[model samples]
Target: MTGPRWIAAAWGQSSLRIWAMAGRKVLTEGASDQGVSRLGPRDFEPALLTLANDMLPLDEVTRVLICGQAGARKGWVEVPHAMVPCAPHAAPPVPAPSRDPRISVGILPGLGQTDPPDVMRGEETRIAGFLLDRASFDGVLCMPGLHGKWVRLRHGIVQGFRTMMTGEIYGLIARQSVLRPMMDDSWDEAAFRHAVDESTRHPETIVSSIFGIRASALLNTPAPGLARARLSGLMVGCDIGAMRTWWHNRPVAVLGTERVSTLYASALAAQGADVQALAGDRLTLAGLIAAHERTGHLEPSAAAHG
Candidate 1:
């Protein structure tokens, strides 16, 4: 491989992030709104080139290792999912058809489950990155996002996992449901904690509890901040309640430094679980670089030199 021979990309639904790399060190970085959701099959290469063309050399092909939705069924190239009870990077990178000879694109495969018919894209790469340094990690990984994932790992292999739609549900309730008028981004910590405690204790009443938010606004006109926090709490609490088997008394490392991650960490801490929050983006990049190295393209000596 030539110098600056690799590009690491994390392509999601709404945005695309890429890093030009000389081995493990990032040489330059770029991003755009041209996510997989907004482009057709033929548009992927061009969208990537628009951001990465300058990083390419004239004679050699620069390998682009991508994770996330770019490997979805409708993405740049539909990569298959690696079944669970396997290493996060169990499936090797699949080559995507590319036009420019200067660049070669390969996407990492996502993880899937059979019994429950569950599937995850992009997140598996993050899991791989998290386990890169923690080889003996024998616990659950709590990743909070629009589609939160609770992953169980033992002996460095993913045993099984579950997905929760807490964030998505919260978004719908806050923006599209009757509770919209009473919601805002401002958060009230006490209200959030109270809601979490209530919902975790009686998750079956969530439907009615949600309605109570609207009713409370109608009668008492609670601050929008409080209402929003309460709504988030209800959704996250329900998830925590259902995932007790995975998290109870376990060492859980929550991914992301975002507000959602904080909420999960707080809720898990309250439940008396050992918890720690990790930086999401850093791990994501590490996973991409790890995949790149595992593919046998970037040599260890080359990385050391860079």
Candidate 2:
């Protein structure tokens, strides 16, 4: 029971989540709003210690394995991206200089593609975790978030991937564009599906079609909910249209929280693609654990020495 305890961190854009662990068993967990976006290089260590310092032992160093934006050029320490056609965790974890000797931090690298020119940080970890138990899986993983990623995998290697700004575009239009007036928290399932069909079938009309939402408001008083749903569908559908090769008549896994994944699943389903939705947290943990194991920094023997 006295074995050395380690830390696992998923430092994202807007939040920092960590688990104090002994091997695969978590002893404690903590979270913070000090996401990578909100901190400077100097602030990364302080932000981590604020949440994990209490979990550290008095005389020995505790190893910390981190994934996500903390490795971005602007984050704690910029780790290089592992070129794709490679393993999900292909890039090694890079160490960050720490002011405190009690803790050692390593940020895992993200994945990058050359031909189409794409990159990802945290999602790579989730992909690794998902594949850990299903090494034979050969398909696409559609991860929806601020920036949605459609990744191609075969024989446990990340063949290539693409990124879409669907979520970010939605946020921008909802908050800043002329479409702002029709945006709200409500949704219309029928309207959403109709919009998806329209976009998927005729993607070229997307640019012109977006203006119709505002025009509809000026002419006929459609509910704000309908307009919002229609907008989301149009955006998501456009993304799907671009990545047809990845999902058309192929097995696809949609990885994300229920809310986000449901929207993507609905869109993919309408296109006649075989899709399965999965929750992402456990997979993220698995990926981080796998990264930790690969480092050998917290192995039973290593921990005992610490």
Which candidate has the highest TM-score of all? 2
Against the true structure, what is each candidate's TM-score? 0.94, 0.95
RMSD of each: 2.7, 1.8
Residue 172 of model 1, lDDT score: 83
Looking at model 2, report the run of 10 residues with the lowest lDDT sum. Answer: 297-306
Model 1 segments more than 4 A misplaced: 1-4, 298-306
Model 2: pairs clashing at backbone N, Cα or C within 3 Å: none
What is the lDDT, from 0 to 100, of the residue 154 in candidate 1?
88
lDDT per residue for candidate 1 within 22-124, as digits (tens), equals: 7778889999999887999999999999999899887776778899999998899899999988999998888899888787778999999997888888889
lDDT of each: 0.87, 0.88
How many residue pairs collide in each prediction? 0, 0
> Poorest 10 consecutive residues of model 1 by lDDT?
296-305
